[model samples]
Target: MVSGTVLLLLTVLSVCGKAAAERKLVYVTVLFRHGDRSPVKAYPTDPYQENDWPQGFGQLSQEGMRQHFDLGQFLRNRYKGFLNESYDRHEISVRSTDYDRTLMSAEANLAGLYPPSGRQVFNPNLPWQPIPVHTVPQSEERLLSFPLGDCPRYKQLMNETEHTEEFLNVTKTYKDIIDLVRNKTGLNKTNVESVWSVYDTLFCESRHNMSAPDWVTPELMEKLRILKDFGFRVMFGVYKQQDKSRLQGGMLLGEIVKNLSTMADAESKKQLKFMMLSAHDTTVAALQASLNVFNGRQPPYASCQIFELYKDDNGSASVSMFYRNNSKADAYQLQLPGCALDCPLEDFVKITKLSISDDRDKECQLPSEGRDKEVIISLAVSGCLLIFLIALLLGVICWQKEPVSSRGYHHVINREVGEES
Candidate 1:
């Protein structure tokens, strides 16, 4: 009896160990919007100047720095065993936007994430230890530096796509905004109204409690407020017309999906545990717009979105999205439209159809049944129309073929002539 019990215990322990080993270490990719800042733009009539903010416009304040530091501490706590007590170059990598605000915020976050340890530690008199964060120039950052703040190509895309049905519908729906922009900036007879920029300006203005522009009447402000709330809808609201999405937003998604495929292809080379991007709210907006996962409100300071890909014991992969904003009490768990929270890697690539958005993906958008559904629906509609026309023609011919009594035909013809006369 004693021998049998010992053997059973050993077998059980072996099974447990094997099961644990089957699961791979978790991988995380985080894309974060920069923290709070002074307004990106100043209205011509506003009293606030560049010096009004201690750091000036488009700069992160002390509060922003503190928020990111706290966020870093949160990450350290959450990923304790996953990360070493001291930073390990092999295990982790960090990338950031080239802008000063983002670069500074990343540094502050790193300070909290790693702190100081061992001989690498600095003097005890200092408040914090130094940690290095890696970054490339804005021009070279393919992952985070998008639309490059105010890119001409992006502007061109937006302008060209404005004529599409979706853009026209959004324009017609917000027809009142043209006059409001004219009144605020005092630029008369403007031809362009970027729905995105308008919403962003209003959201920022409302948040700061700035005086409403003279052109913005109470009714108009209300409409703008609603438009502000609909930013997320405009991004992924599944509008009937899809052609307009080929603009900058589409370009942004195309890049991300291509990157994902490249990463997947190189799986045999090494484990890509995480991809971190230091970016702005606009970058976050573009990505979320593609994934159909955006909240209507602006992404707040130091907002961090996490994408987790799980490799099951059997080698199957799944993904889930987690969004943490400074303003919110808890992170949001995104439920994608067609896929589950833990979506299969294959399903992920399948849903984010490429080349449909851009010509750059000629080879990647391999012909597939899923890609042809819209064309099939259009063809079905055309076939139905043709069948209806043929049936109507046949009915007319049958009526004409009826050998009506000569008297009946003559009477009908006479009636038609009388009416015409």
Candidate 2:
């Protein structure tokens, strides 16, 4: 009787293990902005330039490093057993942008995620060992360097976005401040995108506790504070564009879809556990915009946007998104295209496919449309002309060993057409 019972238990365990094997596990992708730093730009009247900060501007501070380590520790706690105690080549990968802050931030994160362990830490008395983190130059970077704002279409979309209801609303709300900025900056009115820049400079300066300008009155500063609070809305939520679903939003969808598709193609049927991306706020905004799951506020420093993949009981893939930021304690959940909290990857792709815009940003184009369109039309016409010429040449050959004069005439016509093209 005892032997029979033991055999039954073994059979049950085998079945459970098999079921677990079929239902692929989890994969995670984290997209994060660099940690806090001094402002990227300074106004003409600003006191501190790049020299004010210890490492100068844009480098990660010690505070930023500690913040990322804590986050990495948080991730370690979250994925303790899933990610090996030591870095496993097959199980994990980290990609970062080429900036010093981003690269250093990634290193700090790795420090927390995979600390010295077991054999790696040779000394029982001290724990320290070297671990590798990978990165690519920003220009050549693939995974972490997407949604490049250099596209002409994205620029046009941004221009349109600036005219959206939300933008207009903000402008109306801050008209007086806009006037104040105009009077202060004395910039060309035709090229006045810098209205917002003044606020950005002041706010960043304030955060770093830099000395304020004397002209900045208390009331004006308070108004700037109000505008500062509106930063998230302006950058993400309130900024609207009819083509945003395609230009900005679709860019993000393309990335998520690409990663998921790559995994789907893998023969191992390995559950994707992590997708870490070190990127910018624009990257975050574009992604959240595409997902239609934005938090109304812009993603802040070391703001990690996580997409966790999972499997249902039936062995299907599911995905979920979460946003973590320096400003927020809790990670906010985002509703993916399909499959609920644990959404299936297939559904996720399908919903995203709809947001992709074909033209992206045609309005931002500076080059003449006439030339581009004409080139296409002309090319088609030329291709047809070439085919006609070839056919004519063949006909002439078949007619009578192709006379030199006739061939010469055909050659001249081809040359003329080529020159015109």
Candidate 3:
């Protein structure tokens, strides 16, 4: 009886170990928008200008700092077991766009994420310690910034999208509001794209309890908000969204999928546990759009998109996503289109491959029509050159066949006779 009991106990322990090994969280990547900030810019005729802001335009506010700090603490609680109690630089990485608001947000978040403790405390008066946040200059930033201007094909796509039925319908529906905004804001133009600025300026002003002009009413504000949301959709969706994503957000998505693949490899020496990205709402929206999961609403301040890689017992890996747009509640799980809530890493990569461009520069070349025109011109030029070459060859052939051209032969003989004399 004792021997039998020992065998059963050993079998139970083996099963439990296998269970623990299944679906182990191996890596996490969190991409978050910056906290609240002043509007990037105000309309020309708006009452508030750059001077109206405390720290000038586009700067992070105190509220923004608090929001990010709280977010970091939330992260701490959520990843309590996964993350170390102390900061480990080798285990995690933080990168942000080269903007004041994003940079400051990263700093504030790190303060809450890795508050100096016990022996590591440098300043006794403060609860924070310096943590490194990496960034690239805005001109060189492609991973986190959306709608990069370097792609001519993306620009052509936008122009094509503007002429689509859906785009035209939205434009026709908002013509009245667009005109009103143009008049009120004294802007040269107020198309769907430019109208977002009007909404952003008013939204920021309202958030801070600043009184708006008489022309701005609650009804108008709601309409503007809708238009602003539509603008974002137009930028990333509504037409050829997947193709657009391949050029824009897919770049970031590609990097993320690559990281997940690396982490999934048990033999990989990469020991990274977390990667934190601080960027703008556009970045968040762009990424979601690349995945075909954007909610079509402006992501709130400090909104985060989480990607977790889990290793299963069979040496396979899977990915799960969550969105933390609401601070009061837990992040909601997101299901990838054509995938379950917990998607296999292979499926995730495969489904997303269509969105990722193999060669963005090559793909961003002029559209087929433009390339066709270039080909036509090139063919025309080649034809002309070919005709000239053929004519020259015929001329030489005729000259050689004309009994050695008596006049040319006599001239050559006269020159040789003069040299002999």
Candidate 4:
């Protein structure tokens, strides 16, 4: 009996140990914006032009490369044992937008994450191995880019959003700042939506310690910064946020969710441990907006959003999210609005469904505009009346053209044969 009790105790301990080990990380998907780059475009009155940048407009800077490299190292350290020490094409996948800055950022990031190991090193002097980074043309990039065009409903939502009380109030409050940017930047028109680009160019230049015009004082920059943040809020969420997300950010979220679901499948041969996306700040913000956890600020250079999947011994899968907006700060945990940080996969899907559209194209179509609807109805009614009038006129013309006797042919035949009399 004593021996049997000892054996039972040992069995229980072993089971617990196995359970703890089984609750291991199964898959991870990380979406990070490309690092800082030269401004995409310059304002009309700005001193810096496209020619001023070393690589011209929108190319990644050396600092941008360094930022991504550091991020890659952070990822490498974070997933030390889970991912292979060296790059494994089969175990990990990477993708980026088809822009120079984003593509180069991915390359630089990969260099740090998976420095060629042992025989894989092609050159003795340079320890770098080529890793494939996939991308679609900018026109077809729906997965990694946000605020995608071609959705009429999304456009309608945006138009409606601008008219909302909150949007109007913000716009009214910032009218003075908007006017200042218009005058300083030499732009013909400047609104809440259009001012961000101006702010972006100025902000990028400021970061590089470039001198600005006397009109662009520190106080003016602060006001522009606030407007810039408001612009992001308008893009992602201000009114009908979920509906907008269904068309914008939710598309990418659906793909991520599908990938997560695929990894959960026991029969799946693809043991894809890591999936990485290199994209823009809008991409990050749109996704965070869909999750309803946006921090209401622009995601800085090399900012990352991480989704981690874990499975336990009972074959249950759960997901956890983290946001790393500042390199200097550790990633902060994010929870779904109504769910726990480590929410079950099923529950996660269910909660996220509110933001995901079942029929994007159908949802994108605008309902008939009120004035247009009335016009169409009036035109249809007029067309029916015109047809009826034409038919009546034709009948009258036939009666007028007919001979008196032939117009009542049956009566004429009866009189001629004397049958009716």
Q: What are the per-residue Cα lDDT tens digits for candidate 4 across 355-412?
A: 9999888888776765689999999999999999999999999989988767554533
Which window of 10 residues has the lowest lDDT sum in candidate 1? 236-245
Note the Cα lDDT for every prediction shown: 0.64, 0.68, 0.92, 0.91
lDDT of 2 by residue, 10-127 (tens): 9999998997566654677888887766666665556777777788766787877877877888888878877887866577777777888888878788778878776677777755
Best by lDDT: 3
| TM-score (C-alpha, index-matched) for candidate 1 | 0.65
Cα deviation at 367, candidate 3, in Å, is: 3.0
Residue 75 of model 4, lDDT score: 91
Give the range of the ten consecutive residues with the poorest summed lDDT in model 3.
405-414
Give residue 217's error in model 4 in angstroms: 2.1
Scored against the true structure, residue 296 in model 3 reaches a CA lDDT of 94
Q: How many Å off is the CA of 194 in candidate 3?
A: 0.9
Of 2 and 3, the candidate ahead on TM-score is 3
RMSD of each: 14.0, 12.7, 6.4, 5.1
C-alpha displacement of 316 in model 3, angstroms? 1.5
lDDT of 2: 0.68
Candidate 4 stretches with Cα past 4 Å from truth are 1-20, 369-421
Candidate 4 clash pair list: 153-364
Off by over 4 Å in 2: 1-24, 122-130, 140-147, 182-197, 214-242, 264-266, 269-272, 326-328, 337-339, 357-421
What tens digits encode model 1's per-residue C-alpha lDDT throughout 46-125? 55556665677778767778878887887787678777877666656677777888988887887778887776567876
In candidate 2, position 332 carries an lDDT of: 75
